[model samples]
Target: MKRAKLVIGLLGIMLFLAACGNLNSSSMSSSGTNGSKGTQLTGQSTDSNYEGVIENGKYVTSKSRGVSNTQDAGNQLNLKSFEKGLLNVSQQEFSTNKYAFREGQILTKKVVSNWLARESKSNADGLNPKDNGSTSATKRNPIYLQQLEEQDYMIQKNNKLSLGGITIGLGINSVDYYKKTQYGATYETKISKAEAEKQGKAIANKVLMRLRQYDSLKNVPIVIALYRQASDDSLVGGNFFAYSVNKNGTTKVKSWEKLNQKSYVFPIADSQTSPNTNDTTSFDNFKNEVEDFFPNLSGVTAQAQYTNNQLDGMNVNITTQFYSQTEIISFTQFLQTAAQKYLPAKVPIDIQVSSTEGVQSFLSRSENGKKFTTHVFNSY
Candidate 1:
């Protein structure tokens, strides 16, 4: 009886060992404590749903603490591999921005493709500047609100006012739908104070982004830089207050002028002189703006062009906004890539994104940080 009992106990132990041995080797290799160095997922993958999906490549640890068998299947959504070249924006937020360009929204690959491959470049939408029913003012933004209102009314009614003094009517719809909701594919993207605290990082970094080092990482604190639009200096300076907050939650007070685009020199400081820095290069690298940055620009060439005054108009409008939305989108992607490349198979990472540009009720119709609209109406 004793010998039989011993044999049974040994058999049970053997079965457990065999089960452990049967686990998928690759899965286990990239799993828990068993994963190798570079093979493990990084902190970025903490949010991955498939994190730690398997051990030894064939077994998964169930939420109930039981072991289940699974394949070494890779990402289910990594569908971009086979589909190369240009792709269609299948989603609304993506597609709308594609066919029609908007301010503040980051341009995606699909949007760029659609823009270049635009099927219709014709201004036949019945709203052309040359048309009888177009805004008459040569000045983009007229000084008087009444003039703007007048132009706005004309645009809605589809009536063209003479460039000099004549009235032409397309009898077209006048009210601009985009005027009401500027945050859509036609509006300037703005974030909220609360949201900025959350996702305004890369932007903040861009404000302080420099080509050289600013400080050591251990002491570096995340920054939230806000660049508000300011009026041009008139006969007298305006009164306004500014504030700077470090990573420790302490805020430094400041009194300064609101810097306008293409006219102001952004202040720069040495890493040792300044506090902790994120190592993001200032717009110096982007002498040309985002809407303007083309496929062929490098540091030396752009500088040469600037000296020669040959840079394009689009390059001139790059501003805080150009980097804000774009950097956020790229940052999220970088985090995901980093996580997948560094951490274990099962480690979890959750991202909480917030920004002044967070979802909102209204949007601005701005181009390169300026509000602009073109209404063309032709009456035969």
Candidate 2:
């Protein structure tokens, strides 16, 4: 992370990504307005392709990259600390102290509630957290501490994170409208139910690893796991993805891929040869395939692990606590600008995140028995 003036450097990255050439795919290759490197950030809209908060009921800006720059940028949380970038307004008020967190930094904070520590420990269990007889298992009681210690380590790193993903498929038996009968229909969608989670955690890890590449950026990161669930959060089968299973146990994605790989570009689809799903499907085969050979994923307890353990790193202070969301609606462009406007200028690196399809649109159009598959999540 070299010093280039945070604002200008971020702008340079956006511009750079935009002009780098064809995006290499239908979605990437398409031309967009607000060109900011890969961000493709845009402004107020009159275009049909765009859809932020409508001015008169129509999109306010062009459908550039991320989301148009009007709405909130990324899923922002309450800031509590900073070791890397500047904390936004919302983050500063989330916790008791700014120095309370960072990537890999752990704490036994004073109990916010009796169930609070219990939940964090339950999340720490990862796959083995529960017993077969119960719907859930008992969780460890986390220590309630007023203070914490920090530990640091060094490792080889890369700033660039490249991502490629396939849609998640949940094979099921469904009705065949075309055949006018019940049939074994495999649906082909942009992102699968299971794949959305897989790719989300993977993408988070990829970006975190890229951030870890720099010695100057020793600040811990707040792993914000989310989904592109259409605006209606309830419609999603799973609200937000929380954590990735790693060697130690349930932890933030940053902890999962830490020291293991610099970047990961993978797919959501279990196999290139697998087929999609349809209306009548039971999701037995597809779910099994994804579950049997999937990465350690954060089902529901991901947020707790991230909030308590990995969100706070050793040297960097990422005390901010933002919850997850389904999509980056209007502010896609604004966020890119913000990214351009306020990235770590001294320690700048490009991060690209691509879902096979935008999270919002995937659910809006694919409900009512329709299936979606193949999602690509990338960070550059």
Candidate 3:
């Protein structure tokens, strides 16, 4: 259950520029202003029945819901636990640019995580040296202290820039319990959004308050966001509200002006789906085509939500039990080309590949009305 960090590019923009190497130059055919048209993919089908099953327009898989009691008893698909998914760390849409915190998204996550963990421990233990007469602030959480120490060492080792401001994304996990019905059926109980938001804000406030104690932290702006960890493994940003402190040395937190409501759209969420049956029908075909194209894959999970005939985002997660590195790289490139060609220009695409080595995620988005793919984050 190790947590992985995603590096945000400069200007608070999600890592959009890509270096996919000169991978598939000749194999893919460009179809003018749209995406690639013709491409032959090669993969031996692990499931013999799936070989010709998809060709008849049959779907072998169902939409993957994050919550399941029996299907995946161990919760092996949990993205956060494995640090599997790629995050758009430079979520400029969640915070206000009017307030400055050294612009780059790079190691700012360090600042947020360290500051929050320290703050949480201090408040819980009544060790606020400034407020109380306690001489030792050293009794803070060991995890936070370790992280801060590592961050400081890295800064000195690499001559890295000092931590300015940071956008802290907090996913307040909900505790689930089984409730037995009269018919002996059990259902999972999730905490209400209201309660989750309250808890998240309480956590964020503690982080912000402790952050104000340090001279360096006080000067830079801090945006604290609260998101609910959905059953579907998607991080929904701007759930209740996000808070930020001014550039000046002040602990006063104010609400962030901008919120990315579109980020909340998920495949299971009813409101987010397109009313046009054609969109769903078209997407189903696309899903089948992609899965059929990769016959050797152990399994494939694809999710997409369309609004008004436009795609907000499309995610394709695949697990190749065994494959050569060259084949994996070529497969990644092929998928990228397929997405650019088949999907709308504005749609954000996330392509994740999991293999024996680890998980690798590639994110793409539309920047300045131009399609841009995020640099791949390697889980080395």
Candidate 4:
């Protein structure tokens, strides 16, 4: 079979991800003052619109966002739909990596909850009563991580889950409530990409460390990535910050790695009308359909670009490890058919299929006027 080139840099450390159970919850509480400065990342508070600021290694709500009525930004995300969507993806067959994938999903949610709780308690200064006849102040509502879109695993050529690499996408938002009134809700933040990356990495580390508490996951290599939420309904993952734990007996978490993508942005909602050429959302839909049609495949990672809001180029790569030789040929034919059916006819089209042996085949096709050209590389 044709050899495949590995693009992602795998850390030298050995990492494993196992279901976390019966682990000591003591070390898991980074919710303390001396634990993590993440508490300073409190959501909007009740006493004041501003929650707190980080001053000299401390969280102070005295600092403001330069707005008085900034207490409420928008509506709280109804997590019901988000949770249901996540559960749907989780239900899909992830081959040998299903459990770890599921754990990553749950880990992100739990850590967010814990981080918020810790921040609420640390903001005690905001909860103190005033001598001017003011009622006792309540703590700020907790911040949360929302819409964990999907978990992408790094599978080895042996058709086994790679212990050293994993990636998941999610959104960050905060809980805000009225001080005088009792109504409360959560809203997305307007923090810049830099600030969001910083917070995302911090939150990811919190979750990974907790995951490490389990004896099974102690030696496993893992990477957690966080992304800002999208404005639409689809699970279109976007720019992110990756957090990796230190290797070789080191207890420190490494610095965050910022990943930026400049491509056509597409709406999340799936549609049949002229595939949205403005962004890659239509490509994502095609990817979902491919997975649904091919049961032998675990997942498909597809991306595309647009120029002048027109289809410019595209690439669709899928891992087909467990499929037999017969299936691979059929899958290749399916791609050829798909390329002509969905992708722009005039643009260069590349569809790559990789297996446990290596890249099994590569099919590229393009058209000029009414004529078409095709190229195929296969190893059997």
- lDDT: the better of candidates 1 and 3: 3
Give TM-scores for every candidate, taking all chains together and pairing residue i with residue i.
0.15, 0.20, 0.45, 0.36
Write the residue-wise lDDT of candidate 3 on 13-57 in tens digits.
555322212211233211122232332111112111001101112
Error of 2 at 204 (Å): 1.9
Query: TM-score of predicted model 1?
Result: 0.15
Model 2 compared with the native: what TM-score? 0.20
Q: Write the per-residue lDDT of candidate 1 for residues 1-380, one digit (tens) a residue.
A: 01111111211121111111122133223233444332221111211111222223333322222110101221211112111101111111112111111111122333322322213345221111222222323322111100000000000011211111100001111111112235534322232333322222322232223201323212332222222212222111111112232332222312222212221221222432311121113233223232243232222111000112221111111112213444545433443343233212221122223334342111112212221111212125
Q: Report the number of the highest-lDDT candidate.
A: 4
Highest TM-score: give the candidate number. 3
For candidate 1, the clash count comes to 53
Instruction: Enumerate clash totals for all models, in the order shown.
Output: 53, 77, 3, 10
* Model 1 spans > 4 angstroms off: 1-222, 228-247, 251-380
Report the CA-based lDDT of candidate 4 relative to the real structure. 0.41
- Give the deviation of candidate 1 from the true structure as CA RMSD: 28.1
* True lDDT of residue 367, candidate 3: 27
Q: Give me the runs in candidate 3 sitting further than 4 Å from their true place.
A: 1-160, 176-189, 232-245, 261-279, 291-298, 303-312, 319-341, 348-380
Greater TM-score among 2 and 4 belongs to: 4
